[model samples]
Target: MQQLLLQMLDGTVTSLKVFVLTLIFSLPLGFIVAKGRMSRNFLLRGIVNLYIQIMRGTPLILQLIFVYFAPYYVIGFSYDRFTAVIVAFVLNYSAYFAEIYRSGLQSIEKGQYEACKVLGFSKTHTFFFIILPQVVKRILPSLGNEVVTLVKDTALAQTIGVSELFRVAQNAASRMFSTMPIFVAGVFYFIMNYIVSKMFDFFEKKLSYYR
Candidate 1:
């Protein structure tokens, strides 16, 4: 059992890496996406819309396989498995996060923009200082839900053979001919999700002052 735990722990590191890297890249990319989605240029908006549609429409496992294999199939090249997993996860979640941000962005009233203008706030200042904080508060719950889903979605990295936690558990379970390792993995996931939930709740309370 101790050895099994050590193996699982190693796998947890990989899973955690995927989770952290995806969020780091995806959150910023999602903001870019939201901006483009609301762009004045028709062509840019169309392209971003198409990307969001494709990413949100497909199953993540399929995206993982495509990301891993497309380079080899189309360009006669391929990177490492982990890179593919990260790319796929980042792109997929970025689209969802973009929509979440869009909804929050849209929810802000025109009066706020006018008020900021009267206060001599630059557009960037208005967005960053006044508009964005409120948007963050409004979107925290939806963002938290997506974040919890991301915890589970990291398992899809295994579809591209990245050996994340679920993959490690499957290997251990098959070797031992027992489901114990699998169940233990579920505990690991639950703990992660619980922590995420608590963190979001804390953030929500911190921003409750906005209301």
Candidate 2:
């Protein structure tokens, strides 16, 4: 049991690494995608919209497989499995986040833009100072949902043969011929998601002053 716990701890570290890195990359990339989707340039908007459609419309496992294998097939080069998993995760989640951001940005009334314009605020200043705060408040719930989903989705790295927690549990289960390892893995996932939920709750309360 101690051995199993140790193995699981190692696996959890991998899972957490994937989760954290995905969030770190995807959050900023999502904002960039959102901006592109909302751009005044029709071609840029169209391209970004198409990318979002492909990402959101497809199964993430498929994306993972493609990301992992495409370089070898298309470019005759290989990527580390973990790197591919991170790439797949970031690309897939960014699309969802982009839509979330787009909705939040669109929710702000045009009058707010006008108000900022009349105050001699530059577009950059208006966005960073005036627009973004309200968008964050409005999108908090949806963003939390996506973040929670990301916790579970990290398990999908197993599909690409990255030894995340679920894969570790499966390996142990197969060797032991018992379901206990799977149950233990479930506990890990539940605890992680619980922490994520509480963190989001804290932020929601902190930002409630916006109301």
Candidate 3:
């Protein structure tokens, strides 16, 4: 049991690494994608929209497999498994997050923009100081849901052989020929998601002042 716990702990670390790195890259990339989706340039908007559609329409496991193998198949170069997993996860999730951000950005009334104009605020100032705060408040719930889903989705790294938590559990279960290791991994997942939920709840309460 102790050995199983230790192995799980190591695997959990890998899972957490994937989760954190995905968020770190995806959040900012999502914003960029959102901007492109909303661009005045028709060609840019079309390209971004197409990218988002492809990402959101496809299965993440398929994306992971493609990311892991495409380099070797197309160009005769190989990617490290973890690198491939992170790239796949980031690109996939950024599309969802981009839509979330786009919705929040569009939700702000024209009056707010007019007010910023009346105040002689620069575009940068209006966005960063006046608009973004409200958008963040509005999008927090949706963002939280995505974040929670990301916790579970990290397991998909196993499809590319990244040895994340679920992969580790599968190996252990196969070795022992029992389901106990899988159940233990479930506990780990539940605990992680519980913490994420509580953290989001706390943020929601703190931001209730926006209401």
Candidate 4:
């Protein structure tokens, strides 16, 4: 059991890495994609829409496979498996986050924008200062859902041989001929999700003033 716990700990590191890196990259990319989706530029809007559709339409496991293998097929060399996991997860989650952002942005009343204009605020200043905070508050629940989902989705990285928590659990279970390790992995996921939920709940209360 001690040996298994140690192995699981190593797997936890990989899982946490995927979760952190995906959120760090995807959140920003999602915002950018949301802006593009809402842009007046027809071409840009279409391109962003296409990307979102493809990402949301396909299974993430397929995307992981593609990301890991495409480089080898196209350029005759593949990048690291962990890199592929991050790339696939980031791209997949960004599309979902973009839609969440889009809905939150659209939910804000136009009067707020008009009011900002009347205050002679620069467009950038108005958006960053006045609008974005409110958007964040509104989207927190949806974002939290996705974050919890990402916790589970990190297991998908094992498909590409990233050896995340789920994979480690499977290996230990196979070796020990017991399901205990897999159960422990589920406990880890549940704990992660609980923490994520509490964090979002805290943020929601903190920003409740936006309501």
**Candidate 1 on 32-105: residue-level lDDT in tens?**
99999999999999999999999988898999999999989999998999999999999999999999999999
lDDT score at residue 133, model 1, on the 0-100 scale: 92
lDDT of 4 at 196: 95
What are the per-residue Cα lDDT tens digits for candidate 4 across 1-211?
8888898989999999999999999999999999999999999999999999999999999999999999899999968899999999999999999999999999999999999999999999999999999899889999999999999999999998889899999999999899999999999999999999999999999988745
Task: Tell me each candidate's TM-score.
Answer: 0.98, 0.98, 0.98, 0.98
lDDT of 3 by residue, 125-174 (tens): 99999899999999999999999999999999888788989988999999
Q: Write the per-residue lDDT of candidate 2 for residues 76-157, one digit (tens) a residue.
A: 9997999999999999999999999999999999999999999999999999999999999999999999999999999999
Clash number for candidate 1: 0
Q: Which stretches of candidate 1 lie over 4 Å from their true place?
A: none
Task: Tell me how far the alpha carbon of residue 137 in candidate 4 is from the true structure, in angstroms, after superposition.
Answer: 0.7
The global C-alpha lDDT for each of the candidates, from Candidate 1 onward, is 0.95, 0.96, 0.95, 0.94
Provide the global lDDT of candidate 1 against the true structure: 0.95
lDDT of 3 at 181: 98
